[model samples]
Target: MKIAFIGHDLKFLNDAIEFFEHSPNISVKIDKWEGHEIKDEQASLEIVEWADILFCEWGLGNVVWYQKHKKPHQKLIVRMHRFEMNTIYPSQFDYHKIDKIIAISPYVYEEFHRVASIPREKMTVVYNGVQTEKFEKVKSSKAKYNIGIIGIVPKLKRLDRAIEIFEELYRRNNKYQLYIKGKHPKEFGWVWNNQAEREFYEEVFRKIENSPFKKNVHFEGWGDVTSWLKKVGYVLSVSDYESFHMAPIEGMASGAFPVVLKREGVNVVFPKDYIFETIEDAINFISENDFSTNNNLKTFVKENYSLTNMCNQIMDIFLEK
Candidate 1:
């Protein structure tokens, strides 16, 4: 089978792509877009023409383009993430032409069905999987008091909320610290260019600078998060919303307890014990640390969201008529 995967960002598709490439009777090719725009139309067109199946990694312009251009015999699958729902791209899809719509979480599936009126049978939920083996359980001496938040960009991630939680944790125990991983707002050209986004981040920076626990908060910037997870005892997901937040799962795989703020579909994605209803609830949970339960957390991730399980489910979809 000839498969072509197209997307603006292909990072999440790595494991699945590798799995397919090694499988018998399958050939894979990937075409990437330059951010939101098509990097090379001719190159993408050639891949589309050659493949028996086309997989759109994000429900972005690539999917819309593929829907209009693909031959009738070609099967097209598009994966939709949470951010795309807020954009105009989801409405542009011709549901009849799309062979399958893959939602990363149950919440996303319901939203697409309600907002876009897509048939329930047309969509399938495929929770985001983490490479459990890569994030081996290891920790520093001070890891028990450390909190980690991955991806703070695009204000909706709620970096402000994370800081608030960290501050309270610091008040109870001066040993507590926050280690943030990912790019700053200035690193993202689109965010930095927007006046509203620029001001929002400026305020976040100002709050951090003025806070007493400012020295305790560390922005580690972009790096291999798996290695950094060793220093993090708790992985925080205080986002306003999420389809399936992977940071906490990755943290769990690395023996870090996840303290997630309740989001629309978080309950479907994580155990109730890992979720927090309010700031005080999250602080109390972290304060009463039982590090011995870390093994159970790792087991949960391996059993439910392993890389092998995700690949098998996706492979079944690919081979389906």
Candidate 2:
């Protein structure tokens, strides 16, 4: 079977692509749009024609393009993430042309159905899986005091809220520190250009610099998150919203306890004990120093959201008549 993965950002598609690539009966190819615009129309058209299945990673412009150009016999599968629902792209999809719609979580599935009027029978929820083996349990002595936030882009990630939790934790225990992974807003020209986004980040920076624990807060930038996870005893997901936040799951697989802010539908994805209702609740949870459940956390992710499970589920979709 020939499969083509199409998207502007293919980072989340890596494990699924690798799974198919290793199969002797299947061939895989990816065609990434240079940003949102298709730089090479002929190349995209060729891939669309060649593939037996077209997996559109995000329910973005690619879905709109594929819906218009795909052959009648070709199967088109679109995977919708949280951010896309907030945009105009979902309204533009021709549901009749789409064979299947994959939502990363139940919340996303319902949102797409309600917002875009996509038929319920055409949609299915597939939780994002983590490679548990890659993020093996390794912890430093002071790791129990270290908190990690994976991404902080577009301000919705709530880095400011993370600082608030971290501040209170550091007040009680000075050993508590924060390690942020991923790029700064300054790295993205689009984010830096928006006046509101610019001010949001500027204020976030100001808060960090002015805080009493200023020296403890560290922006490590982007690197191997698995390696960084070893130093993080607790992983935080304080996002305003998420389709399915993977960082906390990955942290769990790495044997780090997760302290998540309860966003809408987050309870459907994570355990209640790991989720907090407010900044004070998060601070209190981390202050408890209960690290004995690290093994249980790793087992939870391994059994529930492993890469092998995700690959098999997606492969089943590919082979389904």
Candidate 3:
């Protein structure tokens, strides 16, 4: 079958695409629409028309294009990641034309259901696939004191909370340092489209600046996180929300314990022991645990969240009669 993937989030789609492309009798193509809007109308329509199925990575204006131009026999599937749910775009999708809607997590499916009035059967929860091989690096001895956080631009990521937890750890022992893997919001103005988000970003910046442990804060710009994960003892996912946060799972694969906040759908992905409700609780947990020992976290992720597993589930849905 011929499949066309449309969206700006091609980076996240890499593993899934790799799995699909290697299968027999399957062809895949991707169109890069960076903004909320798709500027190349003719190219977008041509790709939509070429595919037997249209898989939109984000439920934004590109989905609207599919809603208008998708062929009668072609199946339209829109995957709504975390950020799109906050916008009005989900409501704007023409469900009559869409064959399936994939929510990356249960929480996102629930949120999409509330907005779209779509049938529960029409939507499926497929967790993000992580390249476990990339994260199988050995952890350095120095990693015991370094804490890591990935993806810093989104205010929803709650880097401020991660900083607070790191500060608490530093208070007990000055060895703790935060190594952030993504760009700050101040560096990417387009991420915070509204004034409210801009204000929230500014507040987080101020908090980071005013903190006494600011000197220990390291802003490492984005790239392949596997190398960076090797230098960290623990991975922190202090997000206010997530559809399916992959960093912690990746960290676990890299031999680092992942301390993630207990978000609405965290239980669906992470073990309860790794999910903490409060920063103080997280601090206490970190203080008590031995960083040198492995908890089989990598095995759990390998079994459930691997690229092959995720692709099999997605392929089943795509091939369903």
Candidate 4:
């Protein structure tokens, strides 16, 4: 089958690309275009004409565009991943404009129902997954009070919240560390054109560095996950909201006990083996546990959220019709 994938916020990596490419009888012709570069109407119509199946992410504009010009025989599938369900994707579009909808988690689909007419059978939960071999468990040397926060564009991640909790932890014992990876896109040479945002990040980074408990903090820029997971024993994902925060799951794969907040719809979707209510409670829980139980934790995540499982879940949805 000839398939075309449309994504703007995230570009699928090599593994994700290869996973889709190797699917049974699939001939993927990925169209790499962002929302900003979508000025060419002919380009979109051409893609719509070429694809037998369409996969889109968080782009309702594309959804409308596809509805306007998609071939009657082509299969349409839109994937929703952002936290804002009602605000981003409204119900009006679902009445006649779309076909299959893929959500990263069950909670995400529940949220999607707020504005879409998708029934349980029409929606599928395809969890965002990572390669277990790349983000495999590591031999953590010691259980320091280190916290790891990993993401690319973190508008809602609320790293400051994690910083505040760590500040409290450091007050009792000054051995804690917060290792921040990922290069700041708004800070480097790219900032030369957009100085205002650059200055804002400069202030943000400065405050993070001077955050009362700065001595224990370390700014380890972007690199491999295996190398950094060793320095952190626990992960704090205090984001404003999440459709599917795969970072915490990846952290779990690396043996770092994730102390994630119990999202409303997430409890039903993700296993309750290690979720905690508050940062304090999570801290206490992590203090008592060691990396020796990493295998069990990793196994739980691997079974539910690994790349193979994620792809299989999605394939089940595509084949359901």
lDDT of 2 by residue, 1-321 (tens): 999999999888787788789988899889888865577889899997799999999988888888899998899999888788777888888888998999988999998888888789999988898878898855888899899999999799988898988888888989888999999899999999999999999998998888889999999889888899988999999988888989999999989988888888898899898888888888888898677657789889988898888888888887888
Candidate 1 per-residue lDDT, tens place, 193-297, comes to: 999888988998899899899999999888788899988999999988888888888899999999999879899889899898898999999999786667798
**Per-residue lDDT of model 3, residues 67-110, tens digit only:** 89888888888888878866778777777898888888888888
- What is the RMSD of candidate 1? 1.4
Give model 3's clash tally. Answer: 0
Candidate 4 per-residue lDDT, tens place, 99-210, comes to: 7777877777876665554676666777777777776645556555677878634445666567766777777677777777776655546453576645555666687677
Measured by TM-score, the strongest candidate is: 2
Return the lDDT, model 4, position 188.
46
Query: What is the model-wide C-alpha lDDT for candidate 1?
Result: 0.87
Error of 1 at 106 (Å): 0.8
- The Cα error of candidate 2 at residue 242, in Å, is 0.6
TM-score of each: 0.96, 0.97, 0.93, 0.83
Winner of 1 and 4 under lDDT: 1
Poorest 10 consecutive residues by lDDT, candidate 2: 288-297
Q: Which stretches of candidate 2 lie over 4 Å from their true place?
A: none
Q: lDDT per model, in order? A: 0.87, 0.88, 0.83, 0.68
